[model samples]
Target: MKLKSVFINTTNCITPLGLDVETNIRNISKGISGIRLHKNLVYAEQPFYASIIENSLIEEAFSSVSSSEEYTRLEKMMILALMPVIKKMNPVFDEKTILIVSTTKGNITQLSTISETSAQSADLSLMAQKIASFFGFITEPVIVSNACVSGILSLAVAKRLIQSEACNQAFVVAGDEFSKFVLSGFNCFQAVSNEPCQPYSVNRKGVTLGEAAAAACVSANGQNALAEIVGDGAINDANHISGPSRTGEGLFRSVERAMKEAEIKSEQIDYINAHGTATSFNDEMEAIAFNRSRLGNVPLNSLKGYYGHTLGASGLLETVIGIESLNSGKLYPSIGFDEMGLSQALNIITQNEEKELNYLLKTASGFGGCNTAVLFKKAK
Candidate 1:
């Protein structure tokens, strides 16, 4: 039996730079970064750089959607990110439709209080259900929580579910919010950058955390699709609890599998949206993996400088922008890069350029040695 084709039909995102996709793209094209230094002791003991959405902006935008005061800030962001897509497509919430929520920490701030209501709010399943119900989705919602890869991995999951005849249409929403818990955890690992992150740069210190929510519609129907989901692969090296494989073994294998499934060579790839978190090990590991996959020469860029590693939202947010890149034939620069810092060389995009792009590759690696690669072809 032949498998069905899956395509991303519509996309939207809520970020510190903008609320809509076009606005975000405009800011990015102008080299505007959302990362800012914050001295709030609630989030960190010392001043730290991060991309954070303004509370007033979120409240104002969400007021037009719903007047309920019960929704958490993260939920509002998720709803805002998904609202535009749902309005544009006006998809029917039927039995054949599924909702997928991806996140690393859902309302983890609720835990700071340690109350019954807070505990329920922190539950990932409950959060997913609430989002689903808010949209009037009849089917039970699905949760994807695989470290930092949750966003992109959710898309892969949607593809498989549609292909397997389990669901004809899928609504995927991914998000993570800034909280003291997350900041302290990364602080413990000494992975929080003091300034805006510089991926693959000699001066790079570490990652800059951000909060965002992104949504995409995946369906078997190819009508008005942004891009065709051709292939995807995910692998886990289990090298360490926090560190990625030193040899890029899992990432290399993941890319190999994706290319094989797509039946394409690395030379055919027009550009790569890499998971360049600016961490020493992650940047080095990705450089190695791309070179091993013969993708070293492909023009690549990391959106971390612009968005500051939005945790679960990074992959999907980057993927949304990448889809725009394919549609517009424009490449955005890797914002904070100065000089090559990795042992393996990569063709990092430094300035905005227009080119006829056909195939785009998006990759993400995260804790627990998890790595994912998904291939997309420009929709004709």
Candidate 2:
């Protein structure tokens, strides 16, 4: 089904860089890196660090939802960040607003404390449904929890639903909280970085894990005055679940399809927000895929240096980041890069520079060999 018009109405995020998009963009565009030492984590005494959202700020922003101590941090973050925005939309209680939420590690980060699953248990879908119920939506919310790609894929699903007229509108919210579960999983895979992640760097080692949550409102037609979701696509690597494709083949295919769906030629892409997780294999593989796509030279950058790998939220949040960058006509640098890696000629926007951006490309690759590409066109 062809959508008459599906546009991103409103977007917001809660990241380590800052609580909201405005604050996050201001710091990112200024080339500010947000990774810091997590003295409480296993290697906090050592050199490794993480990009964690300030606890105080999160408490302040999200306290209204779970005023008591019932809700978990991740749940509160989603509810608090989305409540105001959703209310502003003035949705009706009985209106069918589909909720497509994404998360790599949901409230499950805290599930180890409880063995039995119950209504009060912190099921990821329950967290999403709680938010939906609070907003008075009558539709049954569908939850998507596909590793880091969940967030981006959630948006892609929402866009399709709008195109199919399955719902009048869809609320895409995704989040992942930092926990020993996530850190240990990555650590077991040796994906922790001793320093802030440096994407596209010759000396890159591993990813610096981070936590965040984000929400975006998409409608059948453009109602809010903002960027439109012009093109989007997703694909599986079918190669590896934990590691990226050797030649970045899956990512390359995803980008190719996404650009085609948008009817955007490779040259038309003005900027690319790469899923540069700061890992040796991931970065190099992405480099190879991007180089093969020939869009690597499209003035690429990774916000991971600033916000770390926000996992699921990385895609939607970074899509928001790309829109902000395009609207402001500024390109951000890939933080922590001292040396260029691989033989690819992809130009990493290594400095905060001003440029006229028309279409910004956002790409994300995650576990299970999932990759997503979304092209957001600047409203002319």
Candidate 3:
């Protein structure tokens, strides 16, 4: 099905890689791993390093927000990323466009402090409202807290909102920050890797969490979009919330639905940006998922090594990287990978930038067995 009017005008973000687009692309394309010992990891006595932006840089970028809570970190990120888009974004505020947000543990870092108080929860919706209000789109805010796939789900939500004529335009934002609560949860699952993840590799460990903030403007007029979002879909394994289907059954179905919506044959896809978290189970399952999805032997890359798994931000953050990759005619390699660890020899990008290709697939699978994939066509 042809989309009537969905245009992604621009993308931007602040991540562990860099502050802006150019620097991030440069740092990430080099396959640089940003994982290091967290200076404050002594709080939990667990060695966990995530992609954290400097507090001073963020303060300078997002002057409108202050307060050193989880919201502050993500708020600063969204404000910085939205700065560029807002500079060129021309839309009627409060009436023209709508705001959509996605995050698994939205501002939950503040919960442990306030949970025992009168306010038993950290309202992520309140934070979303604050963001939209900051951008002068204080009319309506759509919040999606669907676990890890929140980023892509936000994209699909924005696209559908435009298609449904609910709004003339839509601004999609996704972000997440590392916190003691988040770290402890992953630690409970024993999913946290001590080293950088080797996606689709033989000597793989578990996933390393990362923090990031990202936003994009999707409009109906995509004739000159930076990247064309061909098709996207989301599905759940229903097997286990925190674990993946050993057989990759749910992921296979998710890819199948996405291709069906794209109306494009599987072989036409050129490369795949996998949700290669470097976790032993995730990597193994995704390998099977991709191969069964008819994406075997396709050049694949994962940015987790450089950005760590940016949790909620991975979907959009990686999407931004994918777009940057297409625009620059370069493909990033899967970092920290030495051997082919998975059952099959899944072709993973591990060297210098490869030549630009037309169609590529970007996928993400997270807790709750949530699986998502989006196909993109490089703008000609």
Candidate 4:
């Protein structure tokens, strides 16, 4: 049986850079860095660089569509990011449509302050249900919380659902908010970068966290679609809990499988939106993986410098910007890169350059040794 093609029809994002896709793309095109220093916010008495949505802004946006007093910050951001696309689709909540929520640390901020109902408020499933119910989704919501891969992996799941006739359309939303829980965990690992992130740079320190919510509508309908999801793969090398494989084993296999499923050779790939977290191990591992897959010559970049590491939202946020890149026929530079930092060479994008991007590859690696690769093509 021939599987139906899944296309990304529309997308939107709410981040420090902007509240919509076009705005975020314009800011990134001008080399604007959203990651900035915030004093005593997530980490008290310690200044850290992060990309965060201001509380006032969130309240202001939420007030337009809702007067509810019970929504949490994460829920508000998710609603704001998804509201425009939802309005555009105005999709009926029926058996044919499904909602999927992807997040790493939903309502983790509840842990920062002691509350009698703290554990209940921090429930990921409850958060997913609230978002789904807010939109009147008839079907029970699905949740994807697999580390950083949650964002992109949700897309792959949506594609499969359509192909399998489980649903005719899907709205996938992925988000994470900056909180003491996340910051403190990273601090414990010494993975929090002091300066703005610089992926694939010799002087790169570590990752800078960020907060964002990104959503996309996926369907079998091809009309006016932004891009087609051609292929996808997920793998876990199980190298380590917190560290990536020394040899890029899992990433290499994931990219290889995705390319094979797309029925495209490495040379056909026009651009790569890599998961360069600016960590020393991650950059080096990705470089080795690209070289292993013979994708070393493809021009690639990491948007972390502009968005910081938005955790669960990074994959979808980066992919949305990538769609813009392909439509504009221009490659955005990896914002904070200065020089080649890995032993294996990658043709990193240094400056904005005009290129006809037909096939784009997006790769992401996370804790628990999970890595995902997804291939997308221009809808034409």
Candidate 5:
């Protein structure tokens, strides 16, 4: 059977930089970064750099949508991100529509509280259900939580569901918030950067965690679409539990499969939105993967500098920015990058430039040796 075509209809994001996509893009164009140094003793004993959304801002914005204070910070952010997308698309919450929620940790902060309500609220499924019910979604909501790849992986899942005739439309939402649990976990791993992250730079230290929520509307209909979903592939190397494959095996395979499904060669890719976590291993692994996939020459940039590592929201949030880049015909610079630090050379975009882009590739690698690549084409 011939598969159905899928397109990204609308997108929105809630971040420390801004609430709307245009606002965030404008800030990014001006070389603004949301990551900053914070001395929250709850998160860490020492001052740390992270892109944390202001609680006041979230409460204020969410108050406009709903006056209820029962929603968690992450849930409020997810609702705010999806609210505009739903308003723009005005999609019918019928059997043909499906909702997908992606997150690395949902309401993990609740786990810190010693209460039955808090424990129940920490359940991923319950969080998904609450968000779905808030929007009156008729179909059962699907949850995607595969480490950092959950964001873009949710989009891939949406595409397959629509293509397979399971649903005609899908609303994909992803988010993760700052919490002591997350901070301690990264601190334990010694992966938290002291300053704003610098991707692909010799001075790079480690990742700067961020909190954000991003949403996208996917449908078979192409009207007013942002970009067409061309192809996607996800692979696992099982090389290590925490560290990525030293040889870039999983990422390389995932990129190869995505390009193959897109029916494009390495040269056809105009730009790449890489999963540059700015860590020693991740940056090196990506450099190796791109070279192995014969895409070493492709202009690539990582958004980690601007937004920090947003965990589950990083992939989808960057994808939203990437679609804007395709539509605007401009490439955003990789903020905080000063010099090449990878073993394999990559053509990293340094300064913002006007480029007529046709095809874009978005990639993400996560724990458990998982890597995902999704290809997008400029919608005609």
Candidate 6:
């Protein structure tokens, strides 16, 4: 059976660098980075580098559209990121339109500062419902929080739903805010970076945490469509709880499966937007996976150096930017990378350059051995 085609209609991002695609792309093109040294506040004993959106900025943006004055930071950011896209599209919020929210730890910060309303504030379902209700969505919200892959997985889920005729359109919003709990948890495993992350680099230490919210509209008949979500594959190695498979078995299989579904050869890929969290294992594992899949020669770059690792938001956020790159015929450099670090010799974009991009591959690997690969074709 021929599957129905799904496309990303509109996109929005709320990041430290900017709140829209154009601004983020401009700053990224100029090599501007949002990751910076941040003083440890109830998370670490020392300062650490991360890409964080200013609370004041989030509030200002939220206040402009809302007046409740009681929304949590996470809610505010998610709403702000989603508002523009929904407004621009003016999509109907009927039963045919579904709201899918992807987040790792929704309102987790409430745990650090428990209050009388802490229980409700920390409820993921409640947060999802609140956001959906705000937009008057008739259907219940679907939550996808599969570690860091939540963002991209959400897109995959929406595509499948559209193809299944379960929904005519889907509004996918994903976000995660930095919190004492999240930072301390990563610190416990010594995965927090001390400086700006250098993904796919030999000198890379670890991942720098970040916070951002991104949203996209997906439908069968895409208006202002940027790219078509052609194929996707998700797999898990069950190797370890906190670490990825040493051989990148899961990632390799995932990439292979996605490419097969996409019906494209390795050489047909124009570029790769890797998950490159800059961690020792992640970058190394990706190199092995790409080489094993015969995609080692494709030019690739990680956006972590610019926005750090925004956990659940990274996949979708990067996918949005990748679409922009495809339209502009430009590839952004992998900042903070000066040399090859992995065992396999892989192509890494060192500087911004123009290229004819037709098919782009976005991959994400997260804890619990979860890995996902998504193939997108430039919309004709």
Q: Estimate each model's TM-score.
A: 0.99, 0.94, 0.93, 0.98, 0.99, 0.98
Please report, in order, the local distance difference test score of every candidate based on alpha carbons.
Answer: 0.94, 0.79, 0.77, 0.92, 0.93, 0.91
Write out the backbone clash pairs for model 3. Answer: 5-220, 6-220, 7-219, 201-341, 202-340, 202-341, 241-368
Q: Which rank order by lDDT, best down to worst?
A: 1, 5, 4, 6, 2, 3
Which run of 10 residues does model 3 get worst, by summed lDDT?
113-122
Most lDDT-accurate candidate: 1
What residue runs in model 5 are displaced by over 4 Å at the alpha carbon?
A: none
Screening candidate 1 with a backbone cut-off below 3 angstroms (N, C-alpha, C), the clashing residue pairs are none
lDDT for model 6, please. 0.91
TM-score for candidate 3, please give it. 0.93
Taking the tens digit of each residue's C-alpha lDDT, what string does model 1 give over 1-380? 87888999999999998999999999999999999999998887789999999999999999999999878999999999999998888988999999999999988999999889878779998888889999999999999999999999999999999999999999999999988898898889999888799999988999999999999999988988999999999999778879999889999998898899889999999999999999999999999999999999999999999999888989999999999999999999999999999998999999999999999999999998899999999988
> Who is ahead in TM-score, 1 or 4?
1
- Report the poorest 10 consecutive residues by lDDT, candidate 4: 37-46
Q: What is the C-alpha RMSD of each candidate to the true structure, in Å?
A: 0.8, 2.1, 2.3, 1.0, 0.9, 1.2
Q: What's the best-to-worst order under TM-score?
A: 1, 5, 4, 6, 2, 3
Candidate 1 TM-score, true structure as reference: 0.99
Better candidate number, 5 or 6, judged by TM-score: 5
Error of 1 at 351 (Å): 0.4
lDDT of 6 at 44: 67
Error of 5 at 295 (Å): 0.7
**Candidate 3 lDDT, 256-347, residue by residue in tens:** 88788778888888788888888888888988888897787888888888888777778888888888777777877888788888886688
Error of 6 at 222 (Å): 3.6
Tens digit of per-residue lDDT, candidate 2, span 270-359: 999888887888788878888787876789888888888888778888888888888888888888887898666778887788888888
TM-score, model 4 to reference: 0.98
lDDT of 5 at 98: 91
Could you tell me which residue pairs clash in candidate 4? none
Model 4, range 266-338, lDDT digits (tens) per residue? 9999999999999999999999999999999999999999999999999999999998887778899998999
